[model samples]
Target: MPASQYADMFCVEVWPENAPAWNLFEALQTQWRAGSGGVIGLDYGVLAEELRVREIPPADHEQLRADVRVMEAAALQEIYAETEK
Candidate 1:
């Protein structure tokens, strides 16, 4: 689930500091939820614009982006089924 995967797919982040944590992303077909193990959710495009207008720091915002990218890449690779091996 690299941000690149979700890059073309639709997605949205979740509440900060929650149990499900950064594990939730609303996409076109399904929700690629995050587990306790990885990634942070960051808003995108116009959504990010709103956050910026509200004075949210880009550093804080992109921090989540960087995380989502890492987690998503791992998740995508994880889609490899045992049968495929």
Candidate 2:
């Protein structure tokens, strides 16, 4: 089943390798126990903040951002197609 079917709210965490981001997020959302998968969207604002916090070098950040944009565009296209259907 989709996560949205189980949980009313979602907390997406993007963090460094050392950080227990998922565990921490799950702890906060203890009311609704949901497993992760079938993500239809990317929170780019949160992504940017994570990249900044991780101190990703400007050059690498640009490259990563470009890659993420491509992914976000594809996800949007798929979502639009589903809606059109």
Best by TM-score: 2
Candidate 1 Cα misplacement greater than 4 A, ranges: 1-56
Cα lDDT of candidate 1 equals 0.48
Clashing pairs in 1: 1-72, 1-76, 2-72, 2-73, 23-34
Per-residue lDDT over 38-81 for candidate 2, one digit per residue giving the tens place of the 0 to 100 score:
44455556666666776767676666766556645675687668
Error of 2 at 45 (Å): 3.3
Give the CA lDDT, 0 to 100, for residue 79 in model 1.
64
Q: Each candidate's lDDT (Cα)?
A: 0.48, 0.53
Cα deviation at 80, candidate 1, in Å, is 2.5
**Which regions of candidate 2 fall more than 4 Å away from where they truly are?**
2-43
